[model samples]
Target: MKAEYENPFRPPYEFLASGGMVASGLAILALLEENPLPMEIRIGAAAALFLTALVRGRQGWKVFQKKRRLTRGKRFLKEETEIELDDVREIARKNPKKLWIGKGFEWSSTHRQLMKEVQDNMDETKLVGPLPKGEQSKYRETKGAVWVHGLEEEKNEKDIFIPLPDLFGHLLIVGTTRAGKSVFLSLAIAQAIERGECVIVIDPKGDPDLRAAVERACIAAGRADQFVWFHPAFPEKSARLDPLCTFNRVTELASRIASLIPSSRSGGDSFVAFSQRALNAVVNGLLQVGTKPSLIEIRRALESPAMLEELTWKALDAYCVSALESYPSLRDGAYQANAKSKGGKRSKCDIVIGLYRQHVQPSKPNTDLEGLISQKEHPHEHFGKMIAVLLPILDMLTSGPLAQLLSPEYFTDVEREMINIGQIIAQNKVLYLGLDCLSDAMVGSCIGAMFLSDLATMSGQRYNYGTIDDPVNLYIDEGAEVGKHIPFIQLLNKSGGAKFRITIAVQTIADFAAALGNKDMATQVLGNENSWIALRLRDGETQKYLADNLPETTVQYVMNTQGSSSKAGSTEFDANLGERLMQEPAELYPSAMFGKMPTCEFVGNICGQVVKGRIPFIKREEIKQAA
Candidate 1:
């Protein structure tokens, strides 16, 4: 074997060459001391030796230069470029074509350059403007351009920076697992908080990352007392409401469901309406006997002549009895038991976190029609009161004999009442519901839909004057898998333009689209998001979607590349060079797509101008240790 091959870790051949020169210089000096030469010749030889030594001494320096360039390039490419918030002109979703071509290419050249293009075309003047004066000083100026970060590679320099809007109506995020969706949501939340705005986080999966972030935020604001945990199964001990309140809430919900029947033209709608009306009358009539009616009193009222006269009243009596029989403890207010506390006046919680355990069958039966119906039943099996709330009264009404007479026209008032109740909850409180450990997908959807609808209703009423200007944030993590609620998305889309801002975290576009049942709507939601941060994505469709939607230069630089040819007709060639070409230059590309674990960064209008950066992500261990 060759000597160089024998010692694999030895210095390169260049080092050996330099060593030889040093040896030669020493030999020359040794010979000169022994043998006198002509003065002129000796002088010339001495000068040549000196020059050779100088060259040999600095031979290793060339390697350092190469390393320096690589380091500088990496830093320049990865460092987040600051785009002041003020100069932000507009923050709209980039068209597929626009994102594909416009992001990396320079107006004056065809060469695919990264950082140079960003530096050259970036609206430097807008990026570096005077800070706002007075109370406005508390708010940071909006970053005019969007920065793209990739999941796999160092941040690219050729990343696209589109002009951002001063104010975005709303933002929608969609992605699958580890797609950097949560990071994206955190970014938005952090920004919103920095602006001194309020935020309400609704996390169905009980993502610890999101929970920890919110906790830190509360602590930072000196408002830790505002955090509230609302577990339906475990009610607050301090809650002043009596058993009557529980019956009233249920009755009110039933009445609202009954009213919704008119909006439905199907058998299901009529059935639900009749059932809801009956349940409401039964529950309310029984409760009217005293402050809190007993199960016996409820049964007596159901059998009374006054109840039999109304079709809805009959249905209510049957459902109530059936529910009590199924869960006997409910008769004693077990379902509505309050939480245990030490007894000082509890803090007026600004955020209410709800933890509901959903009972969902992981695998559905393989039967045909029966199986389909059984699948729908899985959502209903959850323990939360929300399911009971959404269950149509029509089901109960149609079960016995009144099914034939039930009509949509009879339930209008019920539906309106439901909407009104939702509005009340949303308007009355700044609720931050964190639904932890959701096992079933449907339960998540139900929770998301119900709350989103409530928020939408309240937002529309201007019932509460809150927005990005004086905003409230709704944070959701792993939203697609945990919940597939179209109405919630629609609500978010609507609210983005209103006073509220919603942040959703998901793993992939496909998962979100599948859950939403509409690809276009999913695209609209994701695109409209003021900020989008992408993490490592392995799915082809997701990668394609990102490539198609990102700036053109970025797509070309990050996604398109030619295969390398073997050098000197040999099969082996340098793979690193090919990687370098394909690798997103962090300075040029702010976002990346390919890596073992990649992360993409984005910002838009919904985040508001003030929240450029201030999101926190503390680990559970860190929080515990700190506490």
Candidate 2:
């Protein structure tokens, strides 16, 4: 029978103390026996020593048994085995239980020297360069490597390194403010850049250190020109990041835009749906009219209620015409005079054919639907409400620097060429959007969410149509600012296979819940993420969230019992042992320990592997060297 226990019957400290007492008592009894003491006293002293020695010996035996079990259960020695960043497998659990893997570096006198030497090597580089000789030599070619942050050592000290491919499925990074999460994110981004992977990092705060690291990495890769930095406030100095650059379809793009509306934060209500429908009409209408409408133009077009109503009928007319053209037979009457003859005048088919010929078969798009809507021929009562829904959203975007961000004319800095998001990703280019939250968070967040949604939609289409073997990562820091973007949340489950990796960093679960507006829904989204790295959390909810993800074990206990029974004047002693099975709750990790986890330490569950590790320290000089 196997038993898992928090506190054993004979703990190490108690066993040691009892053993010491027994040893001293036995020695005194031996001395007393040799000193020719009285028979009664000697016998009594011997009886007490014998009883004491027996009790202590029993406890010591139990302690020795526990030690033996622990020794036998160990698969590898922490001191003998060491796991480097590259040594970590993409799937740790797939490796056999007997696999030789160790937690991170064992801290000792030698490791102290190792850390110091690593620091010295980092500082020695005057410019962006390779790792230290010793460190570089240990590296191996694999999927991709992040730094060796920490080890998982509870069951056995095993090295846990997050691989790039594993995160193609998506990663959720939860940490409070100043919890070293941003540092770890920087470390991960630096590693990806060093690996020559194209990465897009969205920083709401516009952190200088992170920007420097990205710049240094670009220099190291000799692709400095490939790096594009976009700051909304200073649009002239940065790359032009227009969300429309990734627009592929009218309906999808409208949905993405609708999700960015702050009013939709309470969940996609009637207004959100109406806004999406209205935006959809204008976008399709502009394309049909051969106008490459930017957000400014789209917003201007939607301001006219008549234009939106007209566009709606035009879209519906176009759809009906196409359906009839593809299946002309379906348009024929159900009861025809002859099998080969056209439908009768009594049939509705003739009417549809006439309308298609009049409005849809022209060489140019027939967008003259003002008469139809004004006369109340097609648009129902919902038309006016839908148009009203899109006005406020358009107002927010067409106001200030945010307007410039989506304007085609304002994006003329690239020699009148807009940045092609799909091409940038397919060709592998680093694009950084530095939207400083110090001024206003809404602009950065709304734009960032739109950009992410568009990219995910494009990537998913690419996966379905073309082959995408290379992975692309989206790093969004201060994710709370973006809030509940339904499109972005949907990407969590779909993008992994499309080679779209997203790492969302937020201050707390509460923030995420507030953004999502439903705590249960937010938790479901978090659970869908294949990997989670929690740094430190103060609230009990967040702590329990981490603890719930930890590993669970089945424990069996053997209860030993001894009892004395008295019958008449005689006494009989009996002992019985029974075995029972007990289940450990979903909460596997100790919640208390995680709440008390010091800064720079993180507990993560990645690809079915549980890990608790510390973020490796990078000195100020080292940061400068990397930069």
Candidate 3:
């Protein structure tokens, strides 16, 4: 391959050629001056030599330089040049004519010296623009503001702030276990509180420092009364969360609970469907007859076949009783049906009919207390299996403090109703649910899933029904620990308009896949969110997922070939620039670098832009002092 010559430095031959041309012209002029030749001859000769030397010298100089440069590779090239700039300070009023330039400094530098020329020609006030506005300054952060983590471009050390409304209302935060996820969480929580959006932090790990930071933000925003530590672990210090009581729609409640009940390969999909169906049946039964709806009641219904049959009959009976009273003609229809069934003997079914007619109230029946009794004919063969499948799940929900969490009335805190999550949204308050996952992992996860589902319901309803006006942010820490119970598909896709800004932090994609039961579904959940911040991911899937979000760019590659020896004299080395796209994760930032990013630094793929940034470091001491 032939060597290619680009821009090159001047060599001795190029300078000598340029000098020779001038020397020859000068020599011709000198000879003409010393000669006694005819004027025309001397002038013509000098002019011809001058023209030839001028043209040939210019061409020869370029050839010599290009040849020299081709022989030597670019080993010593200055990439940039820096120079000093001086500022002149003049006392305009006192002495206009006698101005003194200030001492020189190295702040200014330019590729072309145009800025230096401008500095000398124009009057300037200060070197840098007024120091970036303080992030915490009252003028910068206002009610309903969202603080974007890093700068729009890599220019300075300043926190960027955009209004909360500017975002699409969702975020996915992915990072390894100890990759400063908590730090970013703390920062977001702090700023979110300052922004005055109703903040609800569902932390499975029960972080105390996070609680303190939230308190500081509440204090900073002068909404301390709005700050509530919603610690279900210590129900005595917090409000009761009756999963059954807060909702108006019981079917939705059942669906939420069903969503939390994780499915397993042991049962297959049929078992999952059976549990959900039976749970829906049990919840509907409990809600219909008003038998103090709670997880304990559901547990009782699941444990006893007799109780389950009775509840089912009772719920159906209440509806029958109501229909009969509302239209007394139903009594005649019931009598006709009873007569048709009484041909054989006074069976349990007949006994049920007899009791209903005998105890029927004319104008009024206690809808809450009275219901039909289960007969021998009832209790379908599938009912027992459904109950069996649902028992352990109900047990999980009813175990430990979780059982106490879902009731509006509590043993310790009686005077004030444990404000439910819906109220938390409507009233615009900050709630921190510090689930003690470290101590009771299963119970904590179950409760977290339940609360997040309820919150997602409220968010979805916010737009469809126009109930909640204030923006709500759901900051879920250790989201993967919640398992497959969280209604991720619903939250990721539909919770935004209701102003439920979801920001979920997980350690890895594997954890999410574990929760989702499939990698594709896990990715779908992540895909719904508009913004993502991934820091130091060890899992290849997580790294690949994030790297995939980056746009493809054309990159130049060098192709080196050696020894093209057709003959002994034909041995050669060649280099060429080839361009192709960078496609794979390995071709991008190494997984190792991302797997071990420094604290506060993260690879942020947000709002259609990708950047590797740092979350301004905040110390625990600072939060403590501020608090």
Candidate 4:
């Protein structure tokens, strides 16, 4: 491929040629003055010089115009750049396989110079021009348009794209609220949908525009049936999803629910351990009784002694029936034990317990059943107190529409079709899961956490045994709201090989720290993402984080010095002119520029290439007919 044209940021050769032509013309005139010549010959020579000077000057003027046009900063004054579906189709048609990043040119040395020029010329006070009496300060951020909205156009300014394989490395998008994070996400999600990739969006604090964009993309792709909406707020329209339905082991079910209960700082809280153990026993008991474990069932078993007793008895009877068939002689002993246990006040659990000890425990040694019996025999009040931290989490997850949504009845008929992470991945469906965090934060957080757990579990299964299939694009917006769970980090760490491309958007680095409860862990999570896109950021630490990640460039500047001294009526003057280069020890993209970025503009390090780009707001419309 031919090298792309790049401006050297200096005067072109045409200026030098113009200067030489004028110099030659002047030298000829000087020689004619020194040596006599015919008037006609001198006039002819003068005419030729005049014509040559005019031609050179015209060529120089053209070059100057071209240079000014190339170097001039272009600003997008409109807050949004709207693009129709037809434009998207055209771009897709041209680049059949490229993953569209956004619309802009590659970040080059020329752009760097342009950015520096904008910064050097920046006058913050002048930016609030012609503002009303007291509103100047309110529009201070508008000053950023000098650099944020400023873009330089080159020949053939086209859609910017990164390689499709780069997406598997995952992407992290950081921006403050209303900083075009949603617009970027919408464009990305729509493209993924158009690619027919399995797309999963986990949105905590849902945005309707994001959801509509995905839907329209599906419609445009002729794959509307592949779209599945799962929102806690709209149960009637939302698809039912059972987060607990895809666990391989019963203990996994326990761990999924237990993980939501926040652990103490020491990581050795006795109550937390007890709650996990309790969950394990309950899950085991339910599985043994041929009943699938669900949040409501676990909560009920923990809250009610009668439910635990019933499950324990059912498991014991099932074990006894199987054992009795294998060992016929134990049947008479079991009957005799039950006969001895019969009384008005005596419970059937006591008889089952006696039978298990006499017939099943000695021969088979069902430790799982023993744990269940122990939990049932434990005092209900004490057990509830032990799992007090666990109940509210379960209650939040299984309450109201969530009860049916999270714990869908698999065996029985239900109005909404049940979907699992595994099936969604297998079928390559588009799933939009809205947690509605604004309405009920605790419940929404739990639901989002559980969904991440489910996705993590699915990723593991695919990693261990399943084939590497089409890429799964998972977008988690406001990731800090639900990323408290360990599975989120696990998903980031291990999901790459499983062909899972995870894109996470967060408001700031501190949000991750606050969410994960550790600054280092937040760093670890952010580290997993190979690509970083930064929009408008107002937080100090987040700015520092982004600045640290970006590689530095040598910024060039000119130095001018002059000195004059007069002593004892003798005057001396000296002047010096030199060009100097300095290394910016800090950010390649200035830290302060982060806060001033326009809504739809972004600076990103995508696939090892730093890019300054603008993402247009995608609209559902056809190509307009030309008049």
Candidate 5:
């Protein structure tokens, strides 16, 4: 007997079968006209047709489900096991591969539970914390500040978050050039300003990116009046004579160089002790002569044969006195004393000092020295509230004595004095010093390392009295170039307890890794970062780094397929004609394919929730026009 005929109308197949039924209905209509069928028979036939169609439709649906299962089963299963951000208790980027691509994340069960807990408890007020007590009587603030947006995409983007409550510590950001580092920094600055926090930016290059952002943020936060600019104008002479003024200009240079010398180079403590004694002797000798001499004058006096022959107490005294006489304040020992006094009090201006050797150098040595003294005497006049020192790394390295004096061990007393001055300036106010023009890889690293070490020491000494509740964020652009400084890396990666947050930016992983000195350390720094804003990084190594460091399952989802496919098949059956031979097996498959898309993931409470997006790069003109 022939196999029981199955209902042909089924989903996918149903559409085809329905067309055949319509033709059959037309045939029935024709037959009815020729020989009208009984109403009962017609009803029975109609009912049977309906039942067959229903069965066919059900079967088609089953087939469709089976086809979908072939492709979606694994994905659906994986998604079931995937964890959400809110559920994450602990998050870390795991690197199974040496390269950054194909990195994945390992999460604990606690992560999910904690995230759920956080979500359940989330309240706008709680997230932002209560406004300062006094502000309550002012007005009922209902809305939360939204500074950034649009980071929910699956692709990496350049965006970062710095939460206020979690910001009472230090931070270090490291990335290669073109790595969307600057954009990340901008986010932090914007966030701090929105929260009514004070920020001082020092842009030595005079690029004004940070400065402009700070200004904008201030305006947005209704604190525009608080923004201050402190750029000192150097006389033409100083700009020309930049090399010679090194001896008479800034005192902090010496101190920084001295500090860097591995004590061994300078004969350890003994060398420092000797240097101090020599400086004292020089000072005493000048005092005895009743005349003040400038550094140049003193050097000239020392060169005389008569002074050198005897090297007597009387001769030394005369030389010292002559040098002291040039500066009236020093003649009476008041200059040093006054400096000490000024260093003690809090500075009134929000200072942003710009130190650029090329700009300060003068044509004439005498004129330059005079300008230096004048600037020093009236720092407030030139640098109002903020001082942004734009030091020219190239000029300082190539033309000035600073190149030699930068050596820690060989630093002259004058150089040491400059460093001390820098320390004093850092101590007295809320300061952000940006070292610009640090193009040299080695110098960039050295300066980065030295600045942090010195800053930490000074801050530590006055920690109690000068604890800046307002966190200070350090924005280091081109971090990979400056990554040569191991100390800088160490400080940034580890110095979180202090109210210093380091934000470094670079273009690529290779640059960053090279600057870090060791692959392990580079990994540590990148891994420790609480938040990562991945921009378009097409390099295989970078991609691999992300793959190895981000969640594997998440990466797979990001890499799913999208778009269509087709297939054909044939089936054979035996028919009654000539022992029944029939063959018909045709199939067509059309489906969409999906692969990975760019994705970004935020990991730690330290960074909190991140907001990532492209912000309009507003120039000063644009801002003014908007105003």
Candidate 6:
């Protein structure tokens, strides 16, 4: 469409003006001639002048209309607009199959050029001073309207919507502080809740308004009972979530915890590897004794040799009893003989070790169980040093209410309900995980990372088996804090096939790089997301990152050259007037424009198309009514 449309500024105005002046001068000279011409000739010449003037006036009017259009377009673009609750309900009903992103339209190359034009031509001085009382009140009504003062638009302003299927590819929202990341999240989450999809929000900072918005969304959707809130600070009101509750293998649980240890660069891989092995050993022993593994239990087993001894003894006794039923009578006899004392005296561990060495080790051995007993037999002093880095992390997670929160004793603590990703998806529930990072970043990050690992495991399960009926919409606010975790990357990679729609919000790309300690790791995280919503980005690197993703465009500018020369007496004067069109390769949207965007306003690449949209402050009045 842009290619076919002629430039509105490109009309022959200069030529028409010159011709109009020349014709009027000729008519005057004819009228003032000393030898008057015939009346018919004069009248014909007068008609010719009139025709020239009319043509020139028509062209001038076109230029005027075009200028007005440019002004109207800018005003439309900057108008204070929002999506009310009634509008939301209407859109949901009309487009029952599509995803309503926000209220805006496709921002094409024409719009980009027009915005540049507006920026170059607008009067900056007029923008200063106090606004009209009514206008100021309107601006105060919503944060989005305040920043649209200088924004521009061309045409086709309407609601921004996308296909429901595009969500499988995932979405990434990037913005600076106080730049409406939470506002956009609230709207998106509300839509998902309204759609009856399973929504899981992982908010590290734990914005209270955002939590209220989700609660309101659930209430509006008539699914208030589905809302499950988990916050470490409010254990009495919060739900219990065991990150280690469900895993295909014990090693997965170990790897999930081990990932939190400092990388191999700071601490050698040997230390991390040993820590994982130690976790695996403890987890296996607990499973062998029919006990569910939890953070507190893992810490106790690692910190005390007595607990390890008890686990080993109980596991060995259970294995021996099982062996009597499964194996031959002779094997049972061997197990009984190994339980007897040696020459002087034998300890309980010694008897367990003897039975394992004689009966279990020779025939059929539980390699998982063997790892536990081997760690038990290892020199205590050396083993402690090997797992030194792993203990403190466990302690931080197990301390205070976190111990029961992360590791819920379902049978004993009946007040709090337990939540797992599998159940959250199957039952179509809304789970909001508030890590409360402001209070404790380390603990919050660890919990978030482990929850991501558990989510990754659940995605794997969905991928291998079959998908559930409803799609899972997962929103991770302040993603950079936990986004560096390996499981997060894995979740992004595997979530598509598992019917998961993931949206990650970050302050800036640099934050992710800083958290991951590598730029390439940050790139890896961003690469998995197919769509991006960029709000006011102040970081230079973040701006460049966004601009780099969009394809370059040709921007045309007019270059005018004027020259006049005067020669000696017999003075000859000549003037040459010429104009040229110069084209330069440029980003569709300048990197700096992102810095100037208003709150709740965004320029996004949804799927493949670009969009400039505004997210309204969705009302929660419906929450009160629904309640």
- Among all candidates shown, the one with the greatest TM-score: 6
**Model 5 lDDT on a 0 to 1 scale:** 0.37
Q: Rank the candidates by TM-score, best first.
A: 6, 4, 3, 2, 1, 5
C-alpha local distance difference test of each model = 0.39, 0.59, 0.58, 0.76, 0.37, 0.78
- Model 5 RMSD, rounded to 1 decimal: 19.8
Worst ten-residue run, lDDT, model 1? 350-359
Lowest-lDDT window of 10 residues in candidate 6? Answer: 141-150
Model 2 Cα lDDT, one tens digit per residue, 276-351: 7666656766665455657886776566545554454444445554644643443343224335556533324334
Give the per-residue lDDT digits (tens) of candidate 5, residues 24-55: 65565557646577866765675666666667
As for candidate 4, its clashing pairs are: none
Q: TM-score, each model?
A: 0.47, 0.62, 0.63, 0.84, 0.41, 0.84
Compared with the true structure, the alpha-carbon lDDT of candidate 4 equals 0.76
Q: Relative to the unseen true structure, what is the C-alpha lDDT of residue 269 in candidate 6, on a scale of 0 to 100? A: 82
| Model 2 CA deviation exceeding 4 Å by range | 1-159, 262-268, 304-389, 409-417, 553-587, 619-627
What stretches of model 3 exceed 4 Å from their correct place? 1-163, 246-248, 264-268, 290-292, 305-321, 325-382, 410-417, 556-592, 621-627
**Which should have the higher TM-score, number 1 or number 4?**
4
Residue-level lDDT tens digits of model 3 in 1-627: 444422222233545655676676677678875889887887777777677777777776665543332112121011111111100111211222221111111111110122222233333222212324552232221111011111121123232332355344577778876666777776666656655568889889888877776776666556788887867567667756665554556567666666655565523567566666566667766767766667787777667766766675566566555756543455455556666874764433344345454655444443332322332234656556644555676787767666666655534555544677777777778888888889878777777877777776776677667786777777888888764665656777787776667788888878878777888877777777787777667788777767666654332222334443255566665545543322121223333445545444565655765554555434433322223
Model 2: worst 10 consecutive residues (lDDT sum): 142-151
Superposed model 4: Cα runs more than 4 Å off: 1-80, 89-97, 121-143, 146-151, 326-345, 410-413, 565-586, 622-627
- Count of backbone collisions within predicted model 2: 2
User: How would you encode candidate 4's per-residue C-alpha lDDT over 1-627 as one tens digit per residue?
Assistant: 322333333345666776776777677677786658876687677678767877877877765554344323233323236777656656665765666767676666656665665456545434334645774444323334543333354444556887777877899999998888898888887777767789999999878978888887778777788889999889888898888888766777777877788875523778878888888998888888888888888888887788889888887888788867754455455556657765654466777787688767877888888888888888888988999999888878777888888888733666778888888988989999999999998888888888888888888777777667788899999999988887888889999888888999999989988988888888899889899899889998888888778777655544445555556755665555544443343357777778877676788889788888877878756423222
Candidate 1: Cα lDDT at 191: 42
Model 6 misplaced stretches (Cα beyond 4 Å)? 1-80, 125-155, 265-268, 325-344, 564-575, 622-627
Give the residue spans of candidate 5 off by over 4 A.
1-162, 168-179, 198-208, 219-255, 259-434, 438-451, 462-468, 481-483, 486-490, 493-495, 509-513, 519-531, 538-627
What residue runs in model 1 are displaced by over 4 Å at the alpha carbon?
1-191, 231-431, 463-469, 481-483, 554-595, 598-627
Clash totals for all models, in order? 79, 2, 4, 0, 119, 0
